[model samples]
Each structure stands twice: as structure tokens, then as C-alpha cells.
Target: FHIELPMSLSDLVRLCGFRAAASPIHCRASSPPHSLPPAPVDGLDESLLADDLGAMELELRHRDAYLRSLGSPSAETVARSTLVTDSQVDQIMASEGPLDRLKDLYALNEDNEPSYELASVMLVSMATFTYLNVRYTVQERRLAGVSFEERNKLTVFASKQQASRRKMDYITMRALRLGLKRSASSLIFAPLFLGGAQCISAVRGRSSPLDFLPSGIAAGACVRGAHGLQPMLGGAFLGGFLGAVVGTVVYGIQMYCGLTYEEMRRYRLTERSERDARLMAKLSAAREQA
Candidate 1:
């Protein structure tokens, strides 16, 4: 009796010079099976093919997620996950105008520290003072019939006198002292007003249009308390009136805008996300071209 083996197995046995005493082995005489007709590549279902491709993409995403969990993601994974490249960030920062930068600097969030509020207020105060000073200086010079060239000469002379003999013109000295006083007042009042407003808001449990009135009154009373009770009372009344007017105007604007603080914040976030998406698409196209 003979047992037939595949040709390849028989050849392996022959090459190794192995023989089984129980039965003789012979190579099968039949030809090798032909490979199945390559799965009919021409008339395949397009929808089924698309579904398969989609499944493959999902599987790749899962694989990338797994790799990320292990903290050893591939370069391709990192590239796909990144929102923006370093160059893109640089371009965005460069494209920002001064006004945009200034807005960003002054922008405040609920989570921000008191120091941030203080700094923002200080900046506003400084800007106010600068504008007022410039206007005052121009008006005074005009009233004195001082030409631009003459003013420049006086400024130079004042600087020279101060440098050489520690003496400055009386008008220049007075202006300098006034600026210093205003700056000092700003430093003191900014914190007082901000703290009072925050305290009132916290006590109220929510903000209201009238929240500023008491805060302003307290701030004003403190500012004028050094003079007398009458002055303090007058200051408080004035402050409360101003605060109420400001609050009313602000509330009216909010009503007109048809959006609350939360809505505005969400809108800004949505806009930022859309902008980032556009930038990302542009970057991807550029990468594909490269």
C-alpha cells in the first residue's frame, strides 16, 4: 500500500532521505489547484467597496487612539492630530494688528485674578490721563499764543535747565506734579472701585444693572472722606447718579445687542473654532501640495 503526499512534502522527504517502513509514500499525480479567479475585480459593488474603505479609516483612527494612550504615537498620527504647525502659529501671531493685541490685553475672564483686573484698570486710567494731559497742554499752549517751534524750544530749555541745574520752569514743574498726583490717585482708586464692585456682585449672588451704584458710592465716599461729612455725602450722591446712568446705558446696549454675556462668549468661541478649522484646512492643502 502507498500513501500519496503533496509534491512539495514528498520532495522535502526525498531531499531529507526519509522513509517510513509502514507505508511507502508517493507524490500525488494531480496538478496544483488553480487560485480562485482573482475575485472578479471588474464588476465589484461600488457601495460595498466604499463601506470597506470607511471601515478601514475607522480602524485606523482606533489604532491611532490606542497608540496615543500608550504615549508612543507614530509621526503620521501626531501630524494628523496637531491643530496647527509652528509656522502657522507664527503667521497667525504676525497677522494680528495692534488693535487686536490691545483688545486681547484688556480682555478679562471670570477666572482671572484680581491683579489682572487691577492691571487692566490701571492701563485704562493711564490712557485717560495721557489723553487729558495732551489736550490740556495743547489748550494751554494755544491760549498762551505759543507757536509749535516756540513750545519745542521751551521744552528743550526746560529739559536742559533740569539736567544742568536741577531747575525746571514753574509751568513744566506744575504739570509734572499734577500728572504724578493723577497717577497716584488712579493707583488708589482703581483697586478700590474694582474691589467694591466685585464685593457687591458677590453679595448679590448675581450681577444686576444697579450693582455699580453702591460700589461707586462707597468708592466716592472713601475718596472724599478726608474733607468732611458734607463733602463725602455729596460725592456719594454724585457717584451713585453717575453709576446708575452708566448702568442704564450699558443695560440698554445689551438689550439692543440681543445677546447676554454667556451668548457673546459662546459666539466668540464658535468664531475661533471656525477660524482654526479654516486655517487647518489651508495647512493640510499646503502639506498635500508639498
Candidate 2:
């Protein structure tokens, strides 16, 4: 039913005949251009949606598994996992082989037992690498014009700490922290046997020796006018050997002694000569400030 309205002449004509006035203003006033509504309150992006979907799916599976476990597991477990895209799992499968190989090689009867052989190898390797690192650090300090007294004190302090801490640490915890990381420092260890083999085999090709060693054993000291000869080769070997022996003994004792590094470091401080004590005190202060 159409109702007639009492209106102005233009309004009546426009409504009854669907006509516009003789201008653009009349048509625009009735029908303005359309616009979209504002985006949603949730407004989750694609990545976030994927993340939430994954999380929700995991929770649902967990609950389903709990329910299935109450009586008997259904085919749902296999089916849900089967739905996973292959691309999502290729990387996981690729990395799984090494761990499986390790497990098989050790005959891991149960996950609880530690492989003592692997553990020892890892521990000893770490100790040796650290010792080598100390030597390198000393050489660097010397090249940088650091005084001999400074170098000597640093090395001795490091050695003393190792000696003190040798009695009471756990074999496994120490191995874990030191094991994987020490494996990466083959550079220093390689010089004896491979003599730059690792770097040579790298995809990037061999690096300049100076890039790593920095201090040339044949080069002069930093303080040119007042100096001694450069440190000779095999010098590090003596200190390194001592360090390795110390590390092994200490690790063995601590593993067996049930003592800890913390405990050893606690009472390790000793009485020194007045001059030595003052020097150590100064070093300690400098370290703390740094």
C-alpha cells in the first residue's frame, strides 16, 4: 500500500516518480556512497589464527587422549596425528636420526642410566679446551701490552681455582654444561693434530691464521722499547697438560667425593705474601668494577 505524503513539490515528485532535482545535490542527498564496517574486535591476523588453531587442536587431542586412556585408546590418536602435513614434520625426522643412533649405540636399557664413557670423554674434552682457551687469552693479553705480572696472576688464579674445585663436583651436571659447548672449540685442539684441518674443511674456506691466533709467536712484544723475546712454541703444552691432569683429577674426585664446585671455591682462598695479596686485591677490585 502506498501512502501519499503532504510534502513540498520537489519532495513529492522525487519520491513518487523516483526523479532527481535538476542538480547533482538532490541525488547524492538521498543515496550517499556505501562504505564497509570497521574490522572485527578479535581482529586476529593469519599467523595468530594459525597459532590459536594449533593450540586449540593440541588441547582437544590432550583431552581426547585422557578420555580414551580411561578405557582403551581409540583410532582417534593415530588418525589425528596422521592428519599432520608432511612439511611440518620433515625437519623433526631429519634431526631424529642422530639421537636414535646414540641411544642404540649405548644400548640405553633405560633412559635413567648415564653413559659413563660418553660423559667422561665430554668432561675431559671440556677441561682441555678450557685450558687451551686460557693460554690463548694470556697470549692475547700480552700482545695487547698487558703486563707479564697481569698474565701470570690471571693464569695462576685460574689454575688454583681448578685445583681447589677438583674434589667434589657431580660428573653429569658438569658434563652437560661443558660437553656440547667444548665440542665447538676444535680450532685450538686441532693445531696439534689436524693443524688447521677443521677450518680448511669449512665451506667458507680457510681463515687467516692471524684472524684467530692474533699474536705471532715470532713477533715482538707490544712494548717495543722495553721487551723480551716472543713466547716460544710448546710453552702452552706444559700448562695445558697440567691443566688437563688437574681437571680430570678434580672431576673424578668431586664426582666420587660428592663435593661441589661451589663448596670448593668457598674455602679455596689462601694466605699470600703481603705484596701478592695487595696485587690480588687490586685485581679483584678491577674485576668487580669491570
lDDT of each: 0.55, 0.40
lDDT at residue 72 of model 1 (Cα atoms): 55
Model 1: lDDT of residue 121 = 61
Runs in model 1 with CA error above 4 Å? Answer: 1-56, 59-119, 132-168, 252-290
Highest lDDT: give the candidate number.
Answer: 1
Per-residue lDDT of model 2, residues 45-70, tens digit only = 88888999999999988877775665
Encode model 1's per-residue lDDT on 1-290: one tens digit a residue: 98876678657745443323212232112222231111123477999999999999888888777755655544464456544455555455556554553354336644564334346466766775666666665455344333334455545544555543423343455555555554454444545555555445434333467866787787678777878999999978877886788666754675687543333433444445456676675576456546
TM-score of each: 0.42, 0.18
**Predicted structure 1, TM vs. truth:** 0.42
